[model samples]
Target: MYSISFLIGFSLLAGFAVAASPDVETRSRRVRLSASVIALASVLLALFHLASGPEFFALSPGVLHVLDWMFTIGGVGLALVLLYFCRRIVAREWYIPVLVVLQTGLMLSAEFAEVTPEVAHPFYIDSFTVLMTLIVGVVGGLICIHAIRYMQDYHAHEKTVPNRQAAFYFMLFLFLASMFGIVFSNHLLWLFFFWEVTTLCSFWLIAYSGTDEAVRNGFRALGLNLIGGVSFAAAIAWLTFGPGLHTWELDQLIAAGSAMALIPAVLIAVAGLAKSAQLPFSSWLLGAMVAPTPVSALLHSSTMVKAGVFLLVKLSPVFYDTYAGLLLSLIGGVTFLVTSLVAVNQRNAKLVLAYSTIANLGLIVMCAGVGTAGAMWAAILLILFHAVAKALMFLAVGTTEHLIGSRDIEDMEGLVYRRPAMAAMMLVGILGMFLAPFGMLLSKYTSFQAFLSMDVMLGDGLMLATILAFGSAPTLFFWSKWMGKLVAMPRRLPPGTDPIPRDEAIALVSLTLITYVACALFPLADKVFVIPYTDYLGALGLIPVVAASIPWDNIAIMSLMLAGLFLMPLAFWLRPPRHAEVSGYLSGANVSGSASYRGAMGVERVVESRGYYLSGFIREDIMMRYGMLGAGVLIVVMVGGVAL
Candidate 1:
């Protein structure tokens, strides 16, 4: 119980130590050691929570004492980070794993402590929370580890930008700490504070480069997330003054039921929509690509955006059969459709990733809005798979950009030959997002079923289902195109490069293993986390029970497909090609010795192939404008419905 207080203090104290340390080597060592420690603690805690039962930790004097010390220590850390940024003081770096440690201790203490009637209870430990902790610890720790060498290369490449690794690491840890706080806290005030902390951390990290675009994008992210912040604050105020029913506990708020919580729920859903980067508010996440890749990975995967969906999922009970729920489902469906299509027009790898991240988040948001057992089943799996796979991708692409000196898909042609390991890991990540037997695609299947069973009061089930079907086609198109680009044979010898750094390689490989392991063990995940959470909600009558089972025959096919996913790649790697290579026959006019052929005017020309990026038809700006307008209308109607 007191770990919450300790973590608050430790984060500030450790952040200060890392940010104010004079020696760079010392900082790097601290970051590595701290990150590793936190990751181990997170996994262990997840196991412990799974073995024991989920329980609430009550507030204690020790926690209050730690809060008092936090202000004193936190002020000093803030000053040091600011001073480091000003170039007046030398400092170092640390990563985000410490948050997991803090949360683990809180859960452990709660397991032993007895709840007293007099003490305030602010912590909620559950299987779902444990799952999120595992994600934050494993994924976030690897990201921090990857950043150690990445920032070195980043500063090497961007010589004009001043190195602020110290400030960067400080904010990074703070971000994770806030995430831990959000998932663990039951009280609305505590959740809001942590929520706002992530906003501040994201703004700082996104603007880290000091470039005009970076600064602009940073402010853009800040401005948009503040919308969510303000909405959250409004919801808190409404609950505080408007309804004198119960204390500001999330469970109590939900227990107030749909009619009483409708307005605040609508406000909070808007906040979720913005935070998850749905529709009009999505530009913030897209703009965030200007930041470093670790920041992108952190935000898109385990931390910032995840926090958004987490809140929405938490409020699913209130959303059931409500107009506000319809708003989320519709907006999410539209965002998924539009973003998936727009991704086809993207040439930059990170932009593709950004759009993909938004699209998947839209799917999760849609599922949460459905507020049924089957829907939540899909939502949680989507969260887990998306976190692991997307983080793997962002980190791999970050390394690739450094090696090839570009983040363009075209520039990555023949990457399988030039950077085989990176490309293979990336391929796994890409397929994991959309391919069968992978968690995301499987989760989508569950979501589709959830939609089919949608309540009549919500909206047209078929209409939403139709959007998903249309959206899925583009999802396949963009991912396959990018996959082809990565695995394509080079036209000529590519530029040479150094091997992937040890830290980056470890992070990439670890995530790659996690991707496969998670897919194979998904049934376990469903059993231990997803099913229990869904059952809890269903028992409370917060969500409806529906036909949620995947057919055994379909599972059999998927299991075989899963085998092929790894086996085909392994076979190709192990077996040598039996056929001889041949040069291209360009219009039946091939050069004997070269890849070129005689063309117009008898000039020798090289054959070239490029991706069909449907840019001409699918304009991003046009799509974004219309998508935002549509979602905006739904949001207005949702709010007005609550008010009336």
Candidate 2:
């Protein structure tokens, strides 16, 4: 029967296939098809888990044995190679459906056949694991498809650079496979192996352009992540030798409580902080923007950084109400507040996105540090909404950059008139990040309630609330500025064809619908996914589950507003609503109509306004220096508190 092993193995094997392909066209077709299949498999896996009980396929004794046999002895080697042969059009067309049908049959059989009693092993599967798999498979797949068209344009623009599309796709698929491994592995050693694989993949993809700056940034990323790797290794060593625990299973270690696990947990938390690009470790992600847009989307949203938070949230229970928890939460709080302010100073489109990504990650880290069931619930919601929304924003910006020939926020001032479809999609992405009646906003509201309910001894709830309130202001400022630029109208539309390629358009539209659907169905999501997971934690005595319920009344209101948000836009676009056009009114007489005004010396002056970035006061370099300093201190205190 199909299992998580197949999901991991197929993705790993697909990376090898894509890398070994003879040409660019073959590589593209194989990657797109492979990603689609992986996504389908992920959805089926999640559904099967839901249909069966929570304990369904929780663990089995001989799971790895099956994986070993499938990958060896020339059993499926020949068929795997034939699957990617682009010249055989008929074979390619037939192979996909056949594969899908077989997988579906296998999954159905496994579901109906008697499930064995649950057992413990290196691998673990649960609702959370499947939820993450869905995010990676679905979001990661769309990003891959979008990259197909974006890379072609990228190569055209960077004519002097050597083509390395095959290597790029190889790294992309390998990254996906590594993510599956990270989420599924319960053995700390096994998890470490996958964690390092993602780090290596990240370095390779970031340096694909082979430029001096790209190489430099890639090395910087490698060095910092290696520090994280070393920390993970040290934690494993401590768990095995220091505490005298022979087993490396994470659940067993957490069940040992804070007294036995605090030191190793703090070490692992340091690794998570670095991997997620928290304040002191954030330079690597910012520099990663030198890579293509897909790389940024993949790293920032679904795959790499998400792996970091997944680990941290898993380890949250161990640190609850300890001094370590207070210090760690402070690290995240400081990172969030500082980065949001720094983002306001950035004019480069990607830089702004990168800073915002780090800031939101900081918020997730803060929730994890709180270590209550309710806080973890808020953390997971933030991850889900942020992944979909951020992916949409990054991909939309990439398409807009290609059309306008610049990534500066000022250059996109009249995008709505020039490319209405792209602008509308971009607007949707922007709204998802900060506005009411959207998942991100609602997630933040949940986090606020979770914070209020916390009963931690060492942590000050009011202080955390203050940081959140102050930090959110700058988030609104930066996103609103960019949103305004996208919608601002010019006197006349520019004379050019801002055509979105089919692949890019499909990804953008799909993500937009996903963002809306997720917001619309959030109350149901909370019941189905969040509540159950938290209840399980409470039952295990891992966290204190307080009295929490989804705010149904607020959800109903948001639904009504959401309906208007989408329906009004569709109505305006569908119907012909004619309006009278008017010229701009200047205080003085209009010299050349709305374009120019008369000055004191009878000189013609152009009318214009610009965004207030506060670049002089809120400098990026200055803020980063101080932010890193503050976060570094907090991390030190967390480790010390735990050890002492």
Error of 2 at 459 (Å): 6.4
**lDDT tens digits, residue span 1-644, model 2:** 25677788888888889889887789878878988888888888888775332342233546654533332322133224323331223332443334423422332332233432122566777667777988999999899889999999999999977998887887898899889988888766557767877877887788778887886677667657656766676676666556444446777777766778888889999989989999799999998999999999999999989998889888889878777877778888898999999999888989999999999999989899888987888788888888888999999989989988888888887666667677777777777777637466666776787676666663487788788898999999999899888666654336478579988988888898888777777766776667777788889888998876657787678768766765543443345233223567786768655656787777777776678899888887888899899899888888877767
- Give the clash count for each candidate: 0, 0
TM-score (all chains, Cα) for each model = 0.89, 0.87
Error of 2 at 54 (Å): 5.2
Q: Rate the local accuracy (lDDT) of all candidates.
A: 0.78, 0.77
lDDT of prediction 1: 0.78
List the candidate 2 regions with Cα displacement exceeding 4 Å. 52-120, 436-438, 566-582, 585-593, 596-604
**Model 1: CA > 4 A from native:** 2-12, 61-119, 436-438, 570-581, 588-594
Q: 495-533, model 1: which lDDT tens digit per residue?
A: 776989998998998998898888888889888988788
Assess candidate 2 and give its TM-score to the true structure. 0.87
